[model samples]
Target: MHLTTRQLFLSHVVLLAGSSASALAAPASKTVSLSYIARLYSMRTSVSGKKVVMKNKWNNIEVETNSRRAWVNGVMVWLHHPCRKAGGGWAIRELDFKKGIDPILRSYAYVPTKKPNMVVLDPGHGGKDPGAVGTRKVYEKKAVLSIANRVKAHLEAKKIPVRMTRTTDVYLTLNQRSDYAAKVGADLFVSIHADSAEASSANGVETFTMTAAGCDSSNYYGQSGDKSTKRGNQYDAANAVLGFSIQSNLVKMSKRSDRGLRRARFAVLKNAPCPAALVECGFLSNPEEEALMIDPNYREAVARGISNGILGYITLVNRARK
Candidate 1:
């Protein structure tokens, strides 16, 4: 689980620059085996429902049975083609196994681009939108705003330039929030929120970045075959890097259920002008987690985790650029 600086779990490859026409047209050149993949990567795997969970010394991942989407470590990734059902097991096409998963896994070797100076922090909800209602009757809007402010304070102490979409309790549409970040020319867009679900046992922290174009979403809300591209698709690599950085630290520092990084078509992230991620700090529906969320120290720790993530991402980008 450790490496030299921003070291990653997978091998490395030089990203080929140019068109993907041949890649798109490439047929399933070979049948790839799941067990082979696990053996090759030195990982162990177990299956539950349609998900296969694999873990190794360096990382863990959950891949779906017949889907190209996989959660690698703390980021959602597209495998380009669906995994095939093979003798009641799962296997992926060699095309995506080589071109899609290989390239992406290699890119995880973190590198820096340039000094990212401006960051835009967005508190998920305000005023009319209470977001999630906790079992303790806590409101998500207030909690996220508090968390965002604490994150800002920590980042400012590091001498990083930071800004907020809203400094006070106010309602801002998703469009407005993203537009404000674009207007300010932010290097990163961080949307903070609390999660809730009918299942009270569902408790954990997860981060989401936009699903790349031409790929199925990780959670699979039936967005398969979505070929239309969006502005946010341009930062797919950066989004994964940033989201993994945040989710990794958050899960480690909070000691909460590791929900893993996810992908979604959030309104605020769909057109984001820069690398963007939406963070679900915790599940308010769970009473225990809600109590932790209400604690100032817990919020500070969460903020510290987020702050560390951004700094890590900045380091990665700056190093990559060099």
Candidate 2:
């Protein structure tokens, strides 16, 4: 029987999930060896101090021994658990490999099987809600809207359909933003924002996806807060793929510090109607980053990064369809 694109995609997701259940449930003793991963990807492996570097012709992965930090093509991606020494070698939890590295490396197996029909770009905060106010008086809402507009332009140039939660300066509650995405049948949703912190030293580019069921969020509050599953957990695997794609290209294009692909239970992410990610362009509290936010050239670069990341995800979906 011939299946529609959506049906085929659902079937593929089920098959993939079932096939990996055993591996995912494996005990700590059965953690995946870095050596095995290197061999699987045909990458040469070497140890440098406390880190292991795996390099292939096309990609490179660096895992910090006994740490949750890892880098793929120089973009930092946090692991669910720290790499540990098992069976006389460094290995990572199976979930980390499946949900983090593998998805980014082999996205065709994890991303949606159908190309996205519509991508919703959410420029977070507006109108009465100015979001983070930089030291230079740059507003997060304005910066993100400008950046989102540029991103929409880039995607449209490639013939990809795009929608915005708010095209102009207007306050939108978190629920309203997500509801709009659902109403418009958004295949993928991205919320853009500028971060802020009391410590001016905190500055970087990061991407957040919904926290997986029973996993602690990467942020401090989440470590002590709820770890319960949410609606977005249904797309956990795909979120990893999309989140990593955005973080990777965003860091490369923005030339910002790699704060790593992170996990959070933000309202927009948790309530998303489809696979989604939130991009923190930079910290508005930091003088340097705040200045960059107001720079036209910087905004253009960030926009390109976000657009490229979405295009990369679309490419993966197309490849999966074939």
Candidate No. with top lDDT: 2
Cα RMSD to native, each candidate? Answer: 9.7, 6.0
Best by TM-score: 2
What lDDT is reached at residue 117 by model 1?
86
How far residue 75's Cα lies from its native spot in candidate 1, in Å, is 8.2
Candidate 2 lDDT over residue span 1-322, tens digit each: 5469889988887887788756445533347999999999999999888889999999999999988889898889888778999988999987788778998898888887767999999999999999999888999999999999999999999999999999999999999999999999999999999999999999999999997766777775337666677878888889998998899899999999989999888999999999999999999999999999999999999999999999988888998999
Estimated TM-score per prediction? 0.76, 0.89
Clashing residue pairs in all predictions, respectively, total 10, 0
Q: How high a TM-score does candidate 1 get?
A: 0.76
Model 2 lDDT on a 0 to 1 scale: 0.91
Name the runs in model 1 displaced over 4 angstroms: 1-18, 26-112, 223-227
Model 1: pairs clashing at backbone N, Cα or C within 3 Å: 111-316, 111-320, 112-316, 112-317, 112-318, 112-319, 112-320, 112-321, 113-317, 113-318
